[model samples]
Target: MLLILPLGISYLLRTDGIATDKYIDDRRNYIEQVLDTIDSSFSAYEQLIYTTVKITEELAPDKAEHEAALKLAFSSSRSALVYGIGIWYEPYSFDEKTERFGPYIHHIDSNNNKEEITYFWNTPEYNYQNREWYKTSLAAKEGEISVSPPFFDSDYTYITFGIPFSKEGKKTGVVTVDIVLPQLQGYLSDYNFSDFSGVYLTTKDNSIVFSKTDASNAAIEKHAMEGEQPGLFTDRTAVYDENEITSFFEGIGQKPEILTSETENGVFRIHAFLDRKAIFLNIIFRHSLQYLIFFLFWTSVLYLIIFNSSYLKRNYENRLLNTENERLTEEIFKRKEAESRLTFQAYYDEVSGLQNLNSFMEKEEALQPGNDNRSLIQVSLNNMKELSLILSSTIIDETLLAFTTRLKSVCPLETRLYRARGFSFFVVYDDQKTGSSQKLAEKLQNEFRFALRLGSRDIRLRAKIGLVYFKDAESLEQVLAMSQSAIAGLDVADSGRVGLFDHSVQEQKARHVVLDAAMSQPGFISELYMLYQYIVKTEDRSPAGFEALMRWKSSVLGSTVSPAEFIPMAEENGLIIGLGWFAIEEVLKAISGPLKNSGLFVTVNVSPIQFIELDFPDKLDNLLNQYAVDKNRLKLEITESSAAAAIESFWQIIDELIRRGYRLAIDDFGTGESSFHRLYSMAFDTLKIDRSFVTGLNLDERNQEICRSLMNIGKTMGSQIVAEGVETEEEHRVLREIGIKYSQGYLYARPQPLSETEFGKS
Candidate 1:
């Protein structure tokens, strides 16, 4: 018994050390995951700020232009994390016209539960040029983005991210975006942590950005400043030293097992503290059975030693051994059950009771090269969002479960089903079982045609299915991405559509990948240039004005990409915003330079994405002011489809643009629905007939009558009519007979570079 006591003590010490190490490792992993989330959020904000800087740096340093550009930039990319965004110029640096020129745009939640974007300019009293964020950003090395430490401001804490903007090799200003600390805290709160665990995020200077503890920030900072050693489980058994660390633990009233980790950039530190008592309790609970078993074994050994009767001792030993064995078996079974539960939670969808994307990825990874022909189909419910708005969350969950059950019923027994994401499922099957992917996709679509009964409601759902066949030689990631692209290519207006990732889809995806990469490269926009096509009067074939059409000649592709291809790609990828700005500036430059004395208004096409921006009119005014061009000289052409599909806000933008002295034209007028109603609603300056109608006007009497009717409608509405795609003399004559005043097409002259056009030559 004396020897056993020492051995037991040694075992307890070893077990305690192992448990402490394991706990530390587990907490470290948790901290890492938390850091990952924080990093991802921060990265998104960084990209936004970077894009804003890129847009702001090119502005002409006018106050109105800066205000409009800053407002537009902030509003277009607004995020929940951002409190505000601003531009701070050096003293008398902006346009060299003022001592201070800082413009800030931020959101204000009004009493009516609506967000209002408020704009503010720096006053003499509030000189933002002298602020820490601005000064630090200006002092930073060229091209370096600076992240300011959290500071208290206006009843909230904020961390500012700023990048210095330069003009002609000299730093002239700083562009910054501010993140609200409480919003960050809200993000962190989404993660689940132990009740006894506290997490704190701090800057390198030990200023707390967020803390889960009840201690005040000042107390935490003071404790950190006193040089408290940050280590994993350092002195884990030590009690709280009241005199030395009382302030830090004033609220907790207990010692903490602290673990600290710094971000890779060393900008921020994460401190995770577990209550020492809680840690010890958890450790004891985890190993109590092992300790009990050890004690029982020793007790049985002593019992055997004390008893000399062979039969009685044997019986007693057998019973004790059997009891210990049963307990051990039970413990093993419980552990296995826990492991199985964890595995299910990791790889299976909780709502659908099916395997998840992780399991699908694992299956994909395990596929052999010569395996049977397998096809992957992704089925996505198209109306989940609409249904969610009208139904309770419980109903939505029930609908998802019902949908998955129906999907499983339709799929072959040999098929493997996976929950890809919300209301989306993936089915994998070999050709032998499903016969063909097309047949299976059709069957699934047919199944969704029937109404699903849920309690008292009959819910009808539409699905989009994207299928891809693979021989296991291709990368599954690429296959999956292709499937997604195929799904995206399906018309949103259509329901129950099935698409295959065919050669055309593959080519389009490749082109988009290449275009996205090329556009991301520095100075890629320099490869883009504008061509001018003459808009001539139909009566005399005399040039009235020109349409500025953007063209791109990619050095990377060794060919010129047609606008038909890249424009849609640009719109999809959000590069259209930058490209739209480029087009505006280029057209204004041409009007103010080469075509200054021409007395002709150059029309620029405005994409719906750009036109719908709330600050579109203001941005246009800014550009016009910067270039010193008359707003009337640069016409904005929005597509008829865009106008027809526009909401009430679209009219507001159009009205504002017209109020600011810009002429608006509806391009491709005849192609959209309800043309007469749309024309009657707004006072458009010009109407451009679609190319399709004008293409065969000379040959088809129906097209000629259509063109004539459209021209009459435009004339009746006091709008000038322009006929497009007049390729020959006969088409031009037909347009003239139809009383179309303006015409633009190959018949006048093929679109030519500015230098080769009459305006540039003059």
Candidate 2:
């Protein structure tokens, strides 16, 4: 008995030792996973800070634009991660007229909802420039992000991440994003291995960013109250007296087994703590059966040993078999689960949870050979991209799901719905059921009449439905193309409209394809030319300048394409940039060669896409220098709609052009939602009233008033006013009486080839 006892004891000790090592190793692995999650979260935050800096640097010169842009930078997902964000500029840097301009947007809990409030933090009592975070951020090297020590704000604890931003190679300001400690605490707590285990995120300075236990919080608070720094008492004292710290934890009924890990950047540390008492209890419970078996075998060694020996051996073998079976069962289940997940992902749209395009195609291909009566209706959300700009991705996803649900509710039973793309869906149903397709289209249109509740906002979505009856002769790709063409034929202004694939839509689509193909050819640029129309003084009918209009005569089509038809197509296909550059260079060449001594300034219309290019100013400068044309003789005309849609960088580009001595004009005024503030803020030299208001200005009172108002605005801004589309003497006389200075229309002269004009002949 005595010899057997020592052997059993040795075996038990070895088993317990192995189990303890494995347990600690598993906990350490869990800590590593938690650290990885923390690192990823912080990396995202750092990326957000970098994005904010880039956006601020680009839009800094415009106050309203940059502020709105900064606000937009924080989407719902990002906003939820951060407590607040602040943009602090050096004194008089943002605005030379003011000594300070610091915009701080902070989240506040209002009625149990989080609301963001924007306020200038440059006030006397709360000068952000004097704060430690700001000072440290400013001292940081270029491109380096600095993290502030954990600090308390009101009842909440937070840590600030700061990055310095520069403009034109000089540091201008510091941008900071604040993270709430409790939010991080909740995040880390989710990774706790058990209720008895605690997770903590701490800074390099030992300041606790987050701790899962009330006891840890109380201990940190006690240490803080005792004039020690706000950090873990055990961590601070362990270096000097480890035994004292162990005794302190033991006194509190917590002999903790702690595992510590540092982050890659060493900015933060992760500490995992498990109660020693709980570990001891778990070890005892796990081995209690083995201890009992050993005791029983040894106590009955004389008579029962022979019988019990086989019983014990069989029991051990059965346990091993059960464990192996469970492991194999779990692995098989996991593999099957993985395969099912992959199949679902491939066949379904993750956002809407609807069958995807691949699934739809497969279903369509597998249809019975005689099933030729299926009709496809594409329901498209028109403003999804626009909505994405202002709404959260979560809201957009929810809206899409709700749209699918609503669609399914209206769809006929047995009809299949598929999400063809992000902003569109396909509804395939039987068209043989007499007007079924028409009825379904009507139902889909009616569904959009009601608003969908997306987060806090209720928005009515606009959809365009295109219907196509599947023909046995047409392939699925051909049918899809026809449906898209049908949708394209419907006017965008006619929201919620349904259109059917017809001969006219097909002709238009074919014509568009031909034109696009012609425009894509390398020699298409050479085939393009320009015509100049006279912009004359309204009073004297004498030429002040010429407006350059682009003309396209495609050799491939063997016909001249109208500007209205091909210009928008060019813009859509990104060919406008090339066309715009060609027009600018051609106009300059005409000015420098044919009209050098003509003393007429020529204005060329610029597309919004071209005007927004970062290198637009440089490209224009190069063209101007290459042609040796006077900058004053080349005026750039930007449409009012384009001007209204201009962002902060647009204004910056405009300033660059003005500084280079180029004159700018706002063409087609009164044709869009014209803002007085925008016009007043811009540095335009001319405002050309659109032909719509000028065509009947002599007869229509409303038209006259609009023209007069536009003229008054132009005159007030010291800009030359020109009336477009003037066709008669009466219209010209009225425009003259309305204080117009310049006029460009058929009444003066039609657009003619610059080489055939009288100036070119001279």
Candidate 3:
């Protein structure tokens, strides 16, 4: 009996040890897999953040442009369920002087509904430059992604992803995406542990800890509390008390079998407890197991317990792994939802409930080749940005929405209207319903002529429309660009006017493109020289003086670049300032010989742009002094359209020129608005009648009346009346009958270069 007992004891101990060793290894391998999955899932989420940012920059570029869509990016994203996204912009984007703007903020409110917050002119003063993530990201390399430390807001734990924002291909801001994390302590609360073992995950650096309980219901009470969250702990000691720290060993009734693995700079460890009761049961039954009556039964029962423990160990490991996979699957699903929303918002504008710029581009790309009767109209609300400064953003948004309503009310059933960007709206229509562009523009104007009643404020609206007639199979970009460019070509005073795509503008654009490219060439400067034309005395066909006209005969262009083509372009691009300097220099060098001989004054046209330049007077003074030419003999023609704006602020320059004995003529006088105001207020050498009234002076009574009235105004103002564009002898005779002082056109002589200036003289 004694020998039997010893043999049985040896058998049981040997089997238990072997099984324990095998199961321990299996548990550890299982834990390593769980940790790897978590690390990979985190990396996947980070990639999702990058994807959202890239799409935003591609589609919206500027948040203020497609604000609704940006907010929808958060609301539609699976990430939004986990986190909120906000866009922070540079100061100049929204035109704020002191405070930076976060124009679109997509966040879950207290009710858990996704809400959008738009910040524009009325956004409160907050310096986003001082934010932690903002500073951190600015120091990071361009296009690099980063993660912020976990924090709590609205009782939800969060970690933020900071991404760079770019404008004009330069990084200017950051997109902050904040995600909510599950409460650390409660994450594993439902996990079940056997009497023989407990499982727990611990960080390698001892920063985070989570644990499952044993049969006693004892657990790690302070594994992840305020000590880890609010950062109340400095080191390991701060996380645990001297006696309570021993609870893991004390609660399990023995030193634990600890297993550890690494995860994202942290450790994931499991603590398994030894089953002393099972050991005691095995010992108590050892002597009885070998009895003759119960020998087979006892042996079968013993083997059963041994294999059952192994079974339980395997099942437990599988359960933990399953839990991890399920959680990761849920996260992946949410992330996909987020990505889909971003793509959808890519095509939709969330704020105004209209198609965005990206949608327009996509539609444009998708259009089929077919003959369709269509007219494209681009409407711009003039002074919208200025209005934002004066009125609240709420008011501006209301006005914009109201404007859309007005457009919808007047537009055809087949027409599609899209809010392009900012205050610009694009309308596409069937020509069968739209009639003519002029009628459409007039209808739109009349619709806006009445004030929009917004509570106590009756806000008036003013818009400039550009119309382009489309041809078969024309690309959307071509038509859209043509329409917008036509609008841009309108004179500043012509606001509320519809500029249609016309043959003249098309020719001008073709020449403008040619001139723009050629002006930068080395030959452009040498090609710029003055042509002299006769400013004839009215009674007899004789030259009284000469008007010096700057002409471009480009070798590369293979044609004469008209003043009508490149002059306005030069004024707009600030190239006219340089052109003015070049003209002054060349005219002085050319006419120094001519002026010395005839005492026949030469009038050179100067752009209004030159007067605004502080150095204009100095440049002109230096040119004249250098050549020693009389300033009176060098008259300066100021186009009436150019003089309208100049009459107020440019008077000092005008006075300086006049005081210096330089003559100033109002070129194309009667065609401009406020010509009479200029004629009455400013001192001038001549008021040249615009060519429109001059062409039909002998035929139309209205033209004759206008010419007579302008001559009387010139006489009263002590200014000379010069009739331009005189084509026939009859036109010249009528101008002479009206007592006009001077005339110039193709009548006496066309403007000929200094090489050909003596054609009429001979």
lDDT leader: 2
Residue-wise C-alpha lDDT for candidate 2, range 1-762, written one tens digit per residue: 558866886789678867876787788887888788788777767767876786677664545775665565554224455877778888747455643457767667521335564656567888878888899889889878888877776656678888998878899989888877655654554454564345566776555666544356676576566665433443321222234434445556776777889888776887767676667557866677677667655645633455657776677657756765785698689789999999999999998888998887677863343457888889888767556645667888888989888998989877888998558899888877545788889888988888998667898787889887776325777777877877877765566568887876577777899988988798999998899999999889898999999998889999889999988898766678888998999898899998999899999988876766546898888888888888899899988887776666777788788888899988888787767886677668988889999887889999999988888877789888888999999999998888788999999899999877889888
Per-candidate count of clashing residue pairs (backbone under 3 Å): 0, 0, 9
Summarize candidate 3's per-residue lDDT along 267-360 as a digit string, tens digits. 2333334444444444445434333223433444455566777776566556645755785697689789999899878877655667777777
Give the Å error, residue 712, model 1. 3.0
How should the candidates be ordered by TM-score, best one leading? Answer: 1, 2, 3
- Score every model by TM-score: 0.51, 0.46, 0.41
Better of 2 and 3 by lDDT: 2
Per-residue lDDT of model 1, residues 1-762, tens digit only: 749956995788577878877877887888888886777667767777776776665565556666656666666564656778887777656444543456777657411223434433466767676677778877877667787777765545688888887766677788888887765655665566654355667765555676554444565555566776322112221222323333356434556677777776555677777666666666777878777777777776777778867887889888887887898899899999999999998899988899998888886655454564888888988677556545777998898899888888888798999987666788887887658878898888778888889999999887888887766335777667877876878765545568876677767767789988887778778899999999998999888999999999999888998998888878755688889999989999999999999899999998866766546777777878888998778888988887776544456567777777778898988888745765676678998999999887889999988988888888789898988888989998888777788899997899998899877887
- Model 2 weakest lDDT span, ten residues long: 234-243
* Ten contiguous residues minimizing lDDT sum, candidate 1: 230-239
Q: Is candidate 1 or candidate 3 better by lDDT?
A: 1
Winning candidate number (TM-score): 1
In angstroms, how far off is 290's CA in candidate 3?
56
lDDT of 1 at 120: 39
